[model samples]
Target: MARDYNFWVYIVTNEHESVLYVGMTNDLARRISEHRAGEIPGFTADYRCTKLIYYEHCTDVQDAIAREKQLKKWSRSKKVALIASLNPRWKDLAPEILGE
Candidate 1:
């Protein structure tokens, strides 16, 4: 049987907003929590990019993955513009996803 699932393309930044990380995940809230907790020992953890500044929803997993790859290839200024357009202040949006 085929099941419809939700995928999310999300961006997280460090405390100084000097770095950005783009990723796709099936569970946005859980992923963000992992980032916040520094559970991953890679880029997000190394750079402390735990603030969820932006996200988008896609019903198709392929689309979400493609979007994440595309964003990763984007220039920093372009990525910052994209985030600023939706989140001008670059605020941490984890609470919304966390249902807090």
Candidate 2:
């Protein structure tokens, strides 16, 4: 028997709900924590896109990366719709990741 790993494609937004960033990670919780802590430098850090509003899991890393690319190309409205479909309130899902 073997353990399987999951890859995640996620959308993170800023406080004002104006900016949306698409990303992929193997450890979603740790990655989100890095965003929150401002440890992962670059656009996400500069723009403060720390809210974990949307995510989809895939067993394949290539699938996750493809989904991330697809999301990055979508219009902001379409991205918002996608997030709202899963997280209507646009809640910070990082807390849920910690079982809070």
| Per-residue C-alpha lDDT of model 2 across residues 24-96, encoded as one tens digit per residue | 9999999999999999999999999999999999998888988999999999999988988999999899899
Q: Pick the candidate with the highest TM-score.
A: 1
The positional error of residue 70 in candidate 1, measured at the CA in angstroms, is 0.6
Candidate 2 residues lying further than 4 Å off, grouped into runs, are: 1-3
Task: Give the Cα-based TM-score of candidate 2 against the true structure.
Answer: 0.94
lDDT tens per residue, model 1, 8-64:
999999989888899999999999999999998999999999999999999998899
Q: Each prediction's TM-score against the native?
A: 0.94, 0.94
lDDT of 2 at 83: 89
> What's the C-alpha lDDT at position 36 in model 1?
91
Which runs in model 1 stand beyond 4 Å of their true positions? 1-3
